[model samples]
Target: MSSNLLEQLRKMTVVVADTGDIQAIAQFKPQDATTNPSLITAAAQMPEYQEIVDQTLLKAKSDLGAGASQEDILTRAFDRLAVAFGLKILEIIPGRVSTEVDARLSYDTEGTIKKAHELIAQYEAAGIAKERILIKIASTWEGIRAAEVLEKEGIHCNLTLLFGIHQAIACAEAGITLISPFVGRILDWYKKDTGRDSYPAAEDPGVLSVTKIYNYYKKFGYKTEVMGASFRNIGEITELAGCDLLTISPQLLTELQGSTTELPRKLDPAKATAMTIEKIAVDKASYDKMHASDRMASEKLDEGIKGFTKALETLEQLLAERLKKLEEKAAVGV
Candidate 1:
């Protein structure tokens, strides 16, 4: 294991595990954990987790009638799955676990607020405190505003899928608990756009994006933590040595733990404060106009929302089928 690298990083950043696999999380021993609808949906379908799905359906049946609306059943399934994952993750990690709001509600302020509260309620019912859970929301201006309100009520938020400085500045002004600027996705966009080798780690666009956010946040004294996410490789990960947090996948975490290389310090608040940066603000209208103008941001935000929504829908369908089969078995006295 990269004990030296780990020591070097532990002095600067908090490492977080980005996965739905509890066992893998335990192996890496990240301080925090994160998961999205897609990861939860994938985990729910695994044979090892069939019992979780069956049990969720079984309980929903007892609380809901066969004719219960799919919306209610799906909500219940999502809550159960998220809480179950959080519960398992809590057993290993010492810090919070970020559970995302329904991606479909990314732009719906009220809906996003309601879902964040609902997820926190589920965790509370499971005996997990609000401090141990972070409701992850999209980095849209509306989402950031919703999270700002939620934070006032003592619910922490993790701004996810963030790609630009505008989103970061908005989240900072909004007083979010943390911001997870996507690292690899931005890299993907640049790679696809340039059709050439990406910039070296020192100049990689994705790494630079997070660095800019980190420096801005630190310089401005924004309490919102900066957590780098969606990394494509260890080079990107190691380059972001001193981010407030880095949510890495298990494979990459394993690689980081296995390597014995020197890890450099790429971010430091004292240094960041000395750099020149412009102060910006994005209100609802400005955010909308900016999002509309940037085809990449607009298209990617839309695509990511759809992808996550579809995964949630697939999980719900599977749960409904399971519920129907169980009901039929009980009715037939089989």
Candidate 2:
């Protein structure tokens, strides 16, 4: 009998459940789970979580008073709901749960920090320790700066939407807890730009990008961990078997659990040390220039933030409708 690929991969990389589905997290038992506006929006529609949404809405209305505007009420409800989902996921997983700040706040350093504090406070109020929560921020310069401040307060952060080496270096310099370097999104940009149909796992651009970042991090002894995320296929996952971590969706997790393919350790600190890659320092000017020079990194980062922002808008709409129903019920004295 062959060992499950997921099991083998777990030996080298810490597998994080890249989802917001409570049932799915319970099934896979990943060490950690990440949630964004998109995942939260998708999970909010599930019948099982409807009560959570209702409860959050009711609490927001009760706390904010009846005079609060629908926008204010819905906004508070959405934040509570995000925390509610994270709270539930934390019950299933022993490790941390990453709750993202609003994507619209991606460029607002002060706003991001303020939201991070609020999110952490929510978790703390629910009796969840600060250590078990990661504030996920975009890799924008301002977002990274926000994380730097939050980290000083002992608030760990996961810098997301990262694509360029410049972003990784900056996050490390800021003392971020981790950086989720995307794999599939990078591949998508290259495929669209270069007109390449496919590339083998060994030569996959996404795979290589992550490998370089991992090598760079290890070579410099940066404390920030590299978690390969947004995978397109099992090949990308397998190629990064020795990554510090990998946040995988449930579908790929199932594929790995079912397959028995041998997984090789593709990255190592010793190997990275031997490589001749020069370390580059990144400041505001250099960071902007590097991101601009790399079309894929800049485009994808913008697209990712916009995508999350749209999803957040969708979630806000969902909460608004639910809030309306609640308001109607109260008006009718139900």
Top TM-score hit: 2
lDDT tens per residue, model 1, 1-334: 4465665677789999899987788788889999998889878877887887788777765677768786787677777778888888998999999999988899899999998888888889888999999999988777998999999999999998888877888888888999998888888888888896767887888899899889988888898899999988889988999899999898887777677788878899999899898877788777777778876667666767788889888888877777788779889998
Runs in model 2 lying further than 4 Å from the true structure: none
- What would the TM-scores of all predictions be? 0.94, 0.98
Worst 10 residues of 1 by lDDT: 1-10
Tens digits of per-residue lDDT for model 2 on 135-190? Answer: 99999999999999999999999999999999999999999999999999999888
Alpha-carbon error at 42 in model 1, in Å? Answer: 1.5
Top lDDT prediction, candidate number? 2
Model 1 stretches with alpha carbons more than 4 Å out: 1-4, 332-334
